[model samples]
Target chain A: MRRLYELLEQDTRTAGLTRVAVSTVAVLVVWQLVSMVVTNRLLLVPPAEVAVALVKEVETGAMWTNAVATVTAVTTSFVVSVAIGIAVGLALASSQALSLTAGPVLGALNSVPIIALAPLFISWLGLGFASKFVLVIMVAVFPVVVTTEAGLRATDRQLVEAARSFNATRLQIFTTVTFPYALPFIVSGIRVAWARALVGIVVAEFFGSFAGFGFAILAASQTFDTARVLGYVIMLGAMGLIGSVLFAALERRLAPWRQE
Target chain B: MSTAVRLKIEAIDKVFKRRDKPSIEALRNIDMEVAEGEFVSIVGASGSGKSTLLRIIDGLITPSGGRVLVDGRPVDRPGPDRAVVFQQDSLLPWKTVIDNVAYGLTLARVPKADAHRTAQRFIDVAGLHGFEHHYPHQLSGGMRQRVNVARALAVNPKILLLDEPFAALDAQTREIMQAELLSIWQETRKTVLLITHQIDEAVFLSDRVIVFSARPGTVREEIRVDLPRPRDLHVKRSPEFSGLVDHIWTLIEAEVRAGLRQG
Candidate 1:
């Protein structure tokens, strides 16, 4: 058994790809079998039917329009959240007084489920892109802030002392030592924030939106079009997978020294 | 050694106080001096607080009592006049070898081109020429420590304080680093103070080895090493060298035993 395990580990890249393919095929077969047994078009749809619906949605260009809307909202919220989150994180890390006063408040805010704010946001901003944008920012910014602050705090004390020995000023130490040391951590935080942003935009659209993946899913489900709903859900899953992969690549590019 | 005192420790005392626990005296009335162009080592047991003394001299730590003076001037804070090569590999993981070496110069606001040039010279001296662009994680443990030393030297400080800089390396690497350090010391001729528990290492590199007693550490003895200059690894085998090492070991052996009993 040990020998077999070692052999399997040798060509891990190829073996991993093959294993993924096999698992996907198994899932598809099980899904098709379940769908046939259920025999309820409203409740269940096979992979083939979902694929057909997805292609039709694409051909009609409604999927493109909804996708564009969701992507725009997510990207805008993500950019704004990262900028504000990093700035706030740096400030909190640098100032003991500010952190003492604000840390608990931020923690309290983070513990409150961001979706709970959807009604209040809609009441304030109305059922428009602005509400969705604000909702996404609320959900996404905390991870970046928490992780950035943690990273800066985690810098090795000896490194800081070495900088001090060189007579490095406070600002010089932050830019040259503290900030670069936290880059990898900040990148990982951004990845988590991206996923949260997607969730926020979708849920916001569900509450009230003229266009987006969540709106499309809600409209299809109202008519009991399970295949169209599944298509949009699958697209969201794909978007998340692609975003995480891209972020992983970005982490490697930005902090190659961290890679073993 | 020159007659001028480069660094003077005047009755320095360090007491670590905790919120609830009784304050522990780490060092008591520690007084010593390193003359100009002196290579001095402070050898003690693990809890002797030799490292604390070095940090005090570097101005990284404020002594609870007494003061540290360098060139007759009282030291209060970390300044470019003193550079420390820490026991741990403190190189910035995000920076390349060249950048880590140039860190001090950059902080001093030297032009980028001049900083890199000075850094390149030290990198070459430390035998890290081709590895300029490589990051800290990519280098071997010994190589990383070399970078640590080079970085300290690049700042051109008046005094170099090393806190067991080779304590983390394997035995073979430690010996190689010791020799390299000696050669670098010879070339630079800066006032050096090294803290270590290793008796032989202290004997081999220093012009004077000051032995510290266990807790509430105070200078127990200062042994002058008359070992001829331009020493090599073969010197360790010499009768005089072995005698000095044995003498220093004997001086600290009782302190170590006492420490063990207390713990």
Candidate 2:
């Protein structure tokens, strides 16, 4: 036991891992105790039962089918929303007049809860992948727009003046200085928007999509299949965790100057 | 020394007006002509608008009245004819040392491979050899200024305008930078206009030192330093250099006192 404690305390990474594993096991024990006391299988299920149900869902191939659908929708929506957001952000940033006029309007639109727009998206784009796509775009674009504008506007004035002193053209200055300066901020904005994009796809799927993790949860819950419902919840949480890790890694790789 | 006039500032005046605030006259009738290959320094108290005059000469900002002529043409906008090294490093933080040095040439549409090759020579001259791939933030403040100087010189402009380039440095680094600048200027033979409040710096570097009065700044005196060529750290020990430094100090002292009395 002393040797194990010493090993755990040796390195920060090892210590962190040990702590997380311990907490996870502790939570599982608590959850098992609660499930045993409740005795209602529909409302609560043990961690072991949930693991079994998750394995059954996977073996039946239903998990992969639904996961693929959600992944496809997420990738498509994320790409489209980012593209549109960047184009609109550059447009707004390029001109003071346009930024002033459209900036408040975009902020107001973003202030409205995205879920409130789900009915409109369903009616306009139909209750399919189209609506999900629109909903994700709505959720993702606002953060991108706000962060992009702030980044572009906040570019160092002295840097721009230095470029201009060398007779650099407006386009050259934008490409060489403005864009690179804004890139780290843009990457951070995308990181924030990535989580929102997942939320959007899940919410949209929960309401009207033919298939997704959210749909699987809804279906499992309707039958009071608590084990399968918990499994789907765990899967969704895992997806979000994976996305956050990927973006954080990308941020570190791209913006190394910011790390120190 | 070349007799050709490289830059002519003709009766320039600058007044800054703000909403509901009193109009501030920043520069008034600032008339001077700088000859080709002449190393001139402008000395003044703080808020004397010395920087404003340099900006006007660089064509970064237009004077409210009159104009600056460069190479027999009116300078309405910044061009490749002149380059400025600001007090701050102003080196793009995103770029590596070599890329920052090559930036001006690239803007002039020099091919990338050629620009980088030419930039390497300046990188060596600026004493930044092994740090080409390092970004600005990775370098020290003095190192960044060296990169800044390299970037300005890489463009091969007719004159280098430096606004307190060494002011941010410590005394030791500033002296080292001054010596480096003189050596660089000796090699290139480019005309230079340096602005600073450091009397010894002005006396040590300049062929002629132009002093400006505080507020609505104009030339108070133009002192010629007749010190011998290729002088090193030993020159500052000589009485001639100290005498000139002291004389300029008195003139600036009177100017600052006058400014205080005006208030």
Candidate 3:
């Protein structure tokens, strides 16, 4: 029974995702189910009509445009956050005074919701990609910084002492011991950051955007097209999910020795 | 001084200030020396300051009083001139075996190709030829300690300091490494100062065994090994070797029993 449960769990994770995916499809299917019960199109568009509407939007290339814009902003912000965050984390972990100073300030910033700062960001940088990118950076950078810092500081002192005994220099110690030791933490931080950055891009687009998944959904909502809006939402979720998996694969490849 | 002194340490003292306690006397008025190219082991109970003596002589820690001179020159901060194989190998996890072995030469600013060639040479000497690409984590503890020895000898220091380098290894491996180290010493003729709590290890490895008294450690007795060169595992079984081991054990029994109580 336990063996069967393990197999069930495995198949469930892979196949069960389809059921969860049915949330957006269920939005389409609900009308058909209701039609049998009440025969209403004015109340809810059928699944076929919503598919046609989604295709109609895609045929105009608007779907691709929204995708490209949101992706560009999200990717840029995520990279910026990862590079700066890890650098700062490593630096702060290296110095006691710097860690003491930066720790509290970063913690305070993390506590303040970025959503509440949307108006301020727009007012300061305008509603262009600049504001959205910064918003995404703000959302993404924290986790990377916190996690990388923890990783650096968490290095085994015994290994470090051993390195010193070998007459290893400061640069050598960092490259050999500290960086590799901190890799898992760095990967975790970046994974969470990617998710946050993607969410930031969508939220930025929802409030104000020339084009994005958020704009597409808002347009669908305005016309009371629940199926199209749900479709866009599913696409956004899929994109973030795929991005995280890709990064996780990269991390695993880079630090395969760590698992043992 | 008939054997000719290889190094001299005089009036060595150390005081470490604990936060709440009055200054603790770690060592005091310690004076000792090793003969030229002699393999001498310092044996003492834990906290008997055996390790501190080696550190001071290695120039990792400066003596609070007095001075240590290697070949008559006062010892300074750690230099490639005096290589150390510590309890911890300190191998960089990211560095491959060759890189870790090559670290000292690189710091000395040796040319890259030459340094790699030199490190590769000693890596072979340490009997770690094919494992050159492996990282510290990739090797067993004994293998890692071999890398540590290789790293120290890579610099070809005039003297070598070992602080129980094999204490972490299993008994069987320790015996094998002891033989390897003995052969290495025969080849390099390095004046070695090793510290260990193991009586048999101290007896088996050294040309002279310097035993220390209980805490605020002072040199209790420096029994000459009087054994022949190329000492083997069977040497421990010989009556002559056991005689020296028993003599040193008698001198250190009080401290060793004291240590067992606290530990």
Candidate 4:
């Protein structure tokens, strides 16, 4: 019976992969049909043209430059935002006075449409990496702060009492019980922050930047280079996909006990 | 059991006050003592505040009126001298069995190696010898409670306070765990104060059983179990054991009915 169940499970996994492949092919076919029917290269190029443009950009090293710039900006902003946000989050969760003062301010900031501030940041910081970095931090930091605080606040009361019964000091309880308990929440926050960082970097680049994926797309669209625009968009999508996969793996590693 | 008192609860009373609501008298004028190396159990109806009394003695909750004394010293705060196994499984879910067992020792700043070594001995005592690397989520309810007990024993506290530690387990597991707990307690000879609703469990493991009345809880009676130690499950089948269990159950049942009538 166990062997049969294992075999059935393998069959379902194989079927899932087959379905993904079939869906991709179907989408490509539909794209080809639409492109052929339209026959307007300026508006909608076929997937083949987009792929050719991608290769050409890579051959000329433009793709590498743009990829390197966006990757660096996103990673640096994400790291800084996570560190500062977690520190702020821990402070707010630890003290009622701090949370009461700062929590509503953060909630208001989060409610603002972050993209609207991109131009202001670029104007102030002078259309440079600093503006993009600041924009990404503003966009990405709130999720980390909010989720980290929520996670810490949700630490099990019974567990804390049990720790106290063993005479665990406050710091010891936080480190051993509270922090580890909040890890899954922190990782999820990082996931949201990552996607927001991508969006922020793109918006910052669009407002003003010398070079990046968003800049390349903006430049391509200005000249009606639809294929190149599509190529950069696909690259951004792939980056988001890779980041999401990595965060999911990290969540599993950090919180294996949370598996249902 | 030695005549020396390991724990003394003197006139402890607890009143819980809520905003916009009347105050609750949870425990009233409660007094008890546990001798050195004695296994005592408090059996009471629901809402009898027996668990609250255990928390007061563990120093997790302050008594509104009186205080708890451990070894001639007043307990104003939770300390290493007393350890508690809460009703709920309070294992650190992220930590493995060995790490969870060593948690108290680690908090005391025992070097990691020494803590793990001591934890290993208690793990063996708790009959969790081969599952050192398993997480709490991966263990059965009975096994988790075993780890809970092991964590408390690793600290080697002056007194072990268990608040219905096996209440969440199934009947078979509870009985098996009860037998194992008796063996472990016999081997360690630690002074233990347990709060349980299970009358048979109280009779099977305790040297003395203290019955509490319905809330505003107070000690209604204290029954000394004359049964011998090193007890196995078969002893639970004895007529004497059943008699003690029946007597305690009658007391608690009356309290339960009374509480229901008042409610």
Model 2 off-target regions past 4 Å?
A1-48, B254-263
> Can you write out model 4's per-residue Cα lDDT over A45-146, one digit (the tens) per residue?
999999999999999999999999999998999999999889989999999999999999998998898879888898899886899999999999999999
| Candidate 2, A147-258: lDDT as tens digits | 7878888898999999989999999989988988887777778888888988898888888877888889899889889999999988877778777767776776666777
Candidate 1 per-residue lDDT, tens place, B1-263, comes to: 57899999999999999998999899999989899999999999879899999888888889999999999999899988899999998998888999999999999999999999999999999999999999899999999999999999999999999999999999999999999999999999999999998899999999999999877889999999999999999899999999999998898898888888888
lDDT of each: 0.91, 0.89, 0.82, 0.91
Instruction: Please report, as a residue range, the 10-residue window in candidate 1 chain A with the lowest summed lDDT.
Output: A4-13
> Residue-wise lDDT of candidate 3 within B1-263, one digit each (tens)?
24778789999998887898888687889888787888889998788788887778777677789898887888756666687788865676667899888877877778989889999988888889899999788899889998889888888888899989999899999999999988888888888989898889988888788888867888888888778767889999999988887887888787778888888
What DockQ do the predictions score, one after another? 0.77, 0.67, 0.33, 0.80
Considering only N, C-alpha and C atoms within 3 Å, which residue pairs clash in candidate 2? none
Scored by lDDT, the top model is: 1
TM-score of each: 0.91, 0.91, 0.85, 0.94
For residues B1-263, what per-residue lDDT tens digits would candidate 2 score against the true structure?
87999989999999989899998899999989889999999999877899999998888888999989887899888888899998996988778899999999999999999999999999999999999999988988899999999999999899899999999999999999999999999999999999998989999999999999887788899999999999787899999999999898888897777767777
Winning candidate number (TM-score): 4
lDDT of 4: 0.91
CAPRI tier of model 4: high
Off by over 4 Å in 3: A1-58, A162-180, A224-227, B1-4
Please give the lDDT score for candidate 2. Answer: 0.89
Among all windows of ten consecutive residues in candidate 2 chain A, which has the lowest summed lDDT? A7-16
| RMSD of each candidate relative to the true structure | 3.0, 3.1, 4.7, 2.9
